[model samples]
Target: MGLSPSKRVDAALRRAPAFAAACDDAFDRCLADAQGAFRGVRLYQLADAAARLHASLRASVPLVRRWVPSPPPRARVDAALRAAGLEGEAELSRAQLGEFAAELFREAVLAGAAGIVGVGVAARAAPAVVGRVVAVYAAGAAAALYLSLG
Candidate 1:
């Protein structure tokens, strides 16, 4: 048995502060690494993408509770990057951008799961609950990108 849905949400919320801190640290490190290895618009684009990923995960909790079905994961991520103006930007190749997007998304979702675990939420429910959280985060990220850059 596991915590109820609402209890899981509450546990996640309690865990969020720590999770958010970890996300910030990871994103900053990624940005710093990019600075040394990238420059100019490429660098800026990576940073922007990272920011969107971080912000999207941070904002996902509420939206997850209101879950709606969306396109498959690849499509969603692609749409989000495109909506965020990552396509044909010449700042980064499609492959590069795709790799970065996938990496960042994975990191975000893992962070969510870690947060749930950190808060001592029921282990059994973590995957399903975390998936819902991450799905909504992706949607919000896509929407934010579209509104801001589409």
Candidate 2:
């Protein structure tokens, strides 16, 4: 059998450093693209995504805080959000944070798929990948519910 729900989350947390690095690289690329596109609107969107992702990571994987010695990448992302004019207001609630985590999971899956497929992964493929990733999270949540109800 596969790992339990909590185990899955634990495994994911163990992988957080690598994931965070990949996310930062992706976010930087997106920011560059955004800056070139619409006078930084795209950059702001990316910054928001980065912030939401950071917050979700913080919530889901508390071990991450101890893993890093210096200012973490997520903190830098949050700083970027403030610099982008999204300060003093939490842009994402709990539900939104969950959604952002799902999205990040999806992006990681898609990136891996693209590497395996050896082809260009289109932006349109994101939603489908995200759906699949969210389904995994849903299953884990369901398992937690079953355990709690037991």
Measured by lDDT, the strongest candidate is 1
For 1-150, candidate 1 gives per-residue lDDT tens digits of 855333444345435554354444445555565675643235444555555544554455442222312212544445545655665664554345444444444434433433434333445556778677657765665454333321
Candidate 1 segments whose C-alpha is farther than 4 A from its true place: 1-41, 53-91, 120-150
Question: Candidate 2: misplaced stretches above 4 Å?
Answer: 1-7, 10-15, 36-150
TM-score of every model? 0.28, 0.26
**Per-residue lDDT over 18-115 for candidate 2, one digit per residue giving the tens place of the 0 to 100 score:** 54554554455554655644322242354456554445454544433322222224555454444434444433333333334434443332232223
Clashing pairs in 1: none
Best by TM-score: 1
C-alpha lDDT score of every prediction, in listed order: 0.46, 0.43
